[model samples]
Target: MVSKVNSQTKPRSRFRSRNKLSIKEIFMWLIIIVLFVGMLKVTTLLAKTYQENQHPDSEVYGVWQEKDVAPYAAEQLIFTQDGVVFEGGVIDTNFYFDGKYLEYQHGDTLRRFKFLNKDLTEMKMLLSSGYQPVFQMSEKFQNNIR
Candidate 1:
């Protein structure tokens, strides 16, 4: 007797399928990339705005003493946003003179100076005129003193 076999009853393997991506997964990845790029642009703009507000004005004022004279010469220095003005000069360089009010504009701040003779009486007059006495000396004056 011969045995009979049926080929149509055989089962297929589970790994034999098409490898494809779903539409939903592709859409999710695109959204993530766009959000990252937008965040970077916003951060850059914020940094620029902060830098612009930090600097108020470029002008500055200060006092320096001269080096050549016996007594240092009182110096009133002014620096503009672009450059310097009145490089060097003596305040009340000659004999004791009544203090006079010195006025100038630097950026937004207003600066005033008053020169007085060695005598204390003259210095009082400057004080009454809204000018503050910054320095006092009795000997010869020098440049770059301070």
Candidate 2:
């Protein structure tokens, strides 16, 4: 009976044989982290923009002049930050507008105005009675409306 012993030895590399992370793996992880941070920043900016857009009181602050005034209606309106709205240039009308709509009492009817389009420089509104008007921002409206 002849017993055969295996004498094969594994070759050793010149460098250390450790489970080291490759350069490519490190770069990939770094890129992922950077992208995650970038997305977070973008999300924060978008949220701020949305909140600003929803604040009608802030955007509507200051005075607005009617482009084409009717003989029976006021020609100018001034909206202060304290929810006080003053209309003049003929007959004075005092009212206020919430975030969604503007409400006022005219004789027996309660009038409401809804905004259709709005920006820093211009705003368009639709009245409950199907009247639409575009009000340009007054020169006194110097806040950052964006």
Candidate 3:
């Protein structure tokens, strides 16, 4: 003969009852997920756009130098009919021509120039020591000089 335990005499559980989520919580979660996806898509598009804009094929004309053209330093000038000109202390000087401008840095100085109609339209010269003038000539002007 076992005695039966009464349900009312049993100790109540200490754990709190979890309330069901309301409509507001469900909507908020949906909105959060949507926003997260939207943000991801936007970031991906922006990255693709940035990458696409990074490389372009175009003509560039200018003079550049890897290091300062000291009076005694050996230098070479290279001109291409495609409107690219390279001038530097050494032929191996690391140089690159962007479609619209020429960029060169030596020591703490950075120089940039933009060409228009084969003539320099803008020259940005920043240096800690001396001045270097890079020139651009139109094909007509070059032929006339010759």
2 against 3, candidate with superior TM-score: 2
- Write the residue-wise lDDT of candidate 3 on 1-146 in tens digits: 13345543343332323356778999999999999999999999987566446622223223323234464563333333333233433322443455456555444555554544333433333445576454433222242132
Could you tell me every candidate's TM-score relative to the true structure? Answer: 0.27, 0.37, 0.29
lDDT per residue (tens digit) for residues 1-146 in model 2: 12322222222332345457789999999999999999999999997677557664465666665556574673455555434344533222544454556555555655455554544444455555565676655655536232
Q: What are the lDDT figures for the candidates, one per model?
A: 0.39, 0.56, 0.46
User: Which is the winner by TM-score between candidate 1 and candidate 3?
Assistant: 3
**Cα RMSD, model 2:** 12.2
> How should the candidates be ordered by TM-score, best one leading?
2, 3, 1
User: How far out, in Å, is residue 54 in model 2?
Assistant: 4.4
| Residues forming the 10-long window of minimal summed lDDT in candidate 1 | 90-99
Clashing pairs in 3: none
TM-score of model number 1: 0.27
Q: Report clash pairs, candidate 2.
A: none
Query: How far out, in Å, is residue 21 in model 2?
Result: 69
Candidate 2 worst ten-residue window by lDDT: 1-10
Overall local distance difference test of candidate 3: 0.46
After superposition on all C-alphas, the RMSD of every candidate to the true structure, in Å, is 19.2, 12.2, 10.9
Report residue 22 deviation for candidate 1 (angstroms). Answer: 2.0
